[model samples]
Target: MAIMLYYPLIEPPRDVMYQGLLYWDMISTIVPDLADPDRESGWVRPSMMSPDMAAVADAGLYTPLSIASHVEPSVGIGGVDLTAKLRAALADLCSEMPERELKPRPAVEDPEQEIVYSDKLPPHCVDLLLENGLARVARREPMLIVSPAVHFTLLSVLARQLAHDLTAWQRVADRAEPCLPYTDQPWAFRLAHLPATGKPERCWQVELGGLLPVPDPSVPVSEVIAFRLKYNDERVRLVRAIRNLLRRLGGGEDPDEVFAELRAELADALSDLDRASQRRRVHWMRRSVSVLVALGSAAGAKVSPDYAWLLGLIGGYAVNVATTSMPSLPGDQGVDLSYLQRIRKAVE
Candidate 1:
């Protein structure tokens, strides 16, 4: 059966902030009559009043002006000190609010995981998968479903790490397109299915295939393209090595040794990318490998959540890198010249 993992999109807090600001501004505007000394001279006291008299006249209001005296009020208008009437109004306003409105609203529901059937696949997605050798439609049974959460996590890490460079960030976005369709939505992949052995219970397994080559001639030969091709090739090699090492870990290989080798390879790749002036790719590679290494250490003990996540991430990256770097199809003409001519005609 296919397994699906769904993460709900959450709205930002700006709406709540705007609501609060609007309430505060409205209250401030409506209460000015109580705080403005010019509007009500009694709300403010005479500034020239003796200290003893000022202390004796200590009311909730700021400073009370004597009608016979023309002394300035010690406390200025619109100060923190509020008249009894204004304070009562504020208390009433606060009391009018429900208790539930004072506290923060509960957070949205957490992400979910579930088992599903192969028939649930969208027609377009299934057709694309069949055309790309990702699935076989002849088999009417459901395959093991795998989540794309790891790939999404890696993309997030890459995006954040390389945000400073616009060109580099764009490259990362371009490279992420292959897995975007699956990862961007709440969907899963047909990892593998159990063979029918006529036993009481059949054993199902999960597996990911290596990269598939594509043809795209639209990309002209350039330093940037060359760098991308080389980087992707190196990444494929690293992914294969990681998969092999993870497998060996189950067979009692030394975790420390395997991790050390992986770290060294990752470092070398990062260095090479930096030398090639591929800053964005380098940032992504560095962050991805660092996280993988951290998570890989714990995975050696047993198959943990982190290990599964790392596998999905690396697997998705490997597949996307291979597919995204392919040259554009030769027969695919670019923007229609006729359309441009029509625009020019309209302009004339």
Candidate 2:
């Protein structure tokens, strides 16, 4: 069985590329808009919010799982007839969505007493979601709940703590919050089809994907060739670790402690990946300097590291120099790990 996960909300909130690639089996998300009935928004459900997932599924990318479909409806609670109360709550929250605000409201305005949908979803139907939504999904399957949201966001261990109550069930922060590997997509690069030459570093945006590099004048052979070799080969290692961890998670029905241990082993994988990237960059810079020094001597030009303009002129087509040091990575295991912790508790 593929490892399944629920990314919070609908419409691919953020960083879905990495989220989709890693940590999923029949991967997709289906967070229900409990107030969906009230809003006349574009779509009815998460899966229906196009571009349809069918094309991706056909390509074997990943299938979208409906939150509504995966979870069972709440039955009852404490002989208090929670079913009726929850049904009532759902009705109230769904039917009572307030108008979506386009402008800021007056500060002195009185708040509406009724449960309504707004910027922040009201937790009026939270009980129903807990009993049926999150609880059922976690109990039946070990799922990962991945989200980028921080400072806002799982539960505990033994003694049969409520999935929502336990210590592991806490919205505990990740080992550390990680800034993405790349800030804004790294200039969406693509190699041009033109024959390679060493003239000048030139590139242009294609109508379709991204910048296509026509390396007529420039692009250093050493850097270009060594591009594939990042000096630090941790990506493959990390990928292997993820696969191994998931394999254990998938096929083996290990004891709770063993399972927990495996996950804990990977808890810092994100930090490790970042650290590896930092090291690779450091290697890249040092290698570039070495190449430039050799080239400068051969060309009968004195090159100094402090002359950034000269470095840029010399290395523009060649080197990617290291400027400021990368900040030390924090311990945030990422938000998903906490949800995993919650799932473990809920299932128990």
Candidate 3:
């Protein structure tokens, strides 16, 4: 199963329909900070390893990195410089030494550094990202990153690097096909066609916008990835659903009313949704090369149904989608949005 990791932050609870409700087999709390260290490392300075290590943390990262803050007056005079004489002399001696058994221990790879990897994405990027509230957990399977949006160039860079890493895309590329998995084996079932291997990944990104928030009208659609919404209907519907659910659950805020209303309402809605889901039992369906599926409509086609252009209009390809069943109810972490999620799932 593909693990879903949110970038920047988790998707808004209200619109979990497109963000949380599809594709991934599991949800995770690991918030990956993709922010570049090159752009963010104001804390770094010279005396760093190499230019390529600009993203890497340097001794200067903490700034004025306390050499006893005064260096004990050095017994004579300790001048401030990029390199210390004792350390500089040691480097020369180490260079002359041979068959070194006393060498410093080899630096082991930290599990965290494995999260972001690309010749283009600097290794030190994670250093800054971590400093800025990024966290990490481990996953054995490939990840499907979900977020509202990222810079277009960043998205494309991620696509190029990660497309090959993701098992689904790798299988497709190795087979020279643009198809995605029809089964949830790796949890890549989607509503859009990804570009064939060696083709530009940006086109695939445009179609992926169908699962994200709708972008502003002033922005060119090609410049971003947003849900190909019908007048922002899905977003509006999600927001409305959340609001309604809150009003009903608000009764629980008052202990007196909780017993009177919350318990009864909860029992009823759960019962209703359980019955609805069992009756519907929606599963993945193969999509035509040129169609866009609406958020709630497992059947109706949206504005664009001809997405052959997404594959460069080259070879024909198919996309996969399913109203993936959420057997478990939303937990306390997302309890506020529980009712809306239940309502949306029940209807679908």
Candidate 4:
């Protein structure tokens, strides 16, 4: 018995579609064998694979005859046969095509530096996977189940929706002081695409009801900032508790009491930040102390290895969220924080 799951590769803002087309055009031209693995002759000119050519294709982009065939197989034991098939097809095509210089050769730095070739596809390949209509599949056996263009187009639509929500959330977090530092940290909640094996992984999945967990756009930026400050304060306290416990262990003493005391101290600190006239009171200095304490506690704990490991993981996430910098998009010049208060009326 065999089963298969399919996910489309391309979907929605038009820009992503264009980019994916450009990437595909480039690869199909430079590596024409990719398009027709069994071609006996006729090599494509690399110059013909420009962004303009991609645009033309985008304008007339019709669903490919077979989506399953276009989809690169997964890279593992399950895909072993597919991988061999693809390799053999490419080998046959390449044997009949004339070889040409693809790019400038790298200069040798040291005699011992062995020349190596990268098997990984170019970075732009991400444009294809992240764009609007590519289908993702889980298969037990190979089969032509869908049109490539149709799957890509469908998936692209979903991806665009996700991207829009993420962008809006990014806007809100940029205005919120507490979330700003954690924006770029891969572990913290933020939009990111991480490479896993040969595929792209959506690193940020924090969402509420299919949308980003953010306050209404109309809410005053000040209120959002205040909310984040309070939220961060709680995390700070947790970090402190962990640290105090570790510090006590360092002195060959039990950390239970120290953890309780540190929690109390954190409560006081949060109070001070809340009532303080200046926002600077809640800056990195106060947060760093709490983080350090948590780290210390994790190090000094004499508990079972599992407990210690759990403590370490929590403390680490806290520290990373507290100290990391905010992320910015490619075209983002800067955000207008004032817009936060001007957008729609506040919603609960």
Candidate achieving the largest TM-score:
2
- Pick the winner on lDDT between candidates 1 and 2: 2
Off by over 4 Å in 2: 1-4, 33-47, 52-54, 75-238, 243-348
Preferred candidate (lDDT higher): 2 or 3: 2
For model 2, how many clashes? 25
**Which residue runs does candidate 3 get wrong by more than 4 Å?**
5-13, 17-23, 28-152, 168-274, 277-348
lDDT of 3 at 195: 26
lDDT over C-alpha atoms for residue 230 of model 2: 56
Model 3 — TM-score against the truth?
Answer: 0.21
Report the C-alpha lDDT of model 3 over 15-62, residue by residue, as the tens digit.
231222322232322112333457432222344223312211221211
Instruction: List candidate 1 segments past 4 Å from native.
Output: 1-227, 230-233, 277-348
**Candidate 3 weakest lDDT stretch, 10 residues:** 329-338
lDDT of 4 by residue, 53-156 (tens): 34433444312212222224322112223233223323332354332311112332321111111111122222332241221221322111223222222222
- List TM-score per model, in order: 0.22, 0.26, 0.21, 0.21
Which scores better on TM-score, 1 or 3? 1
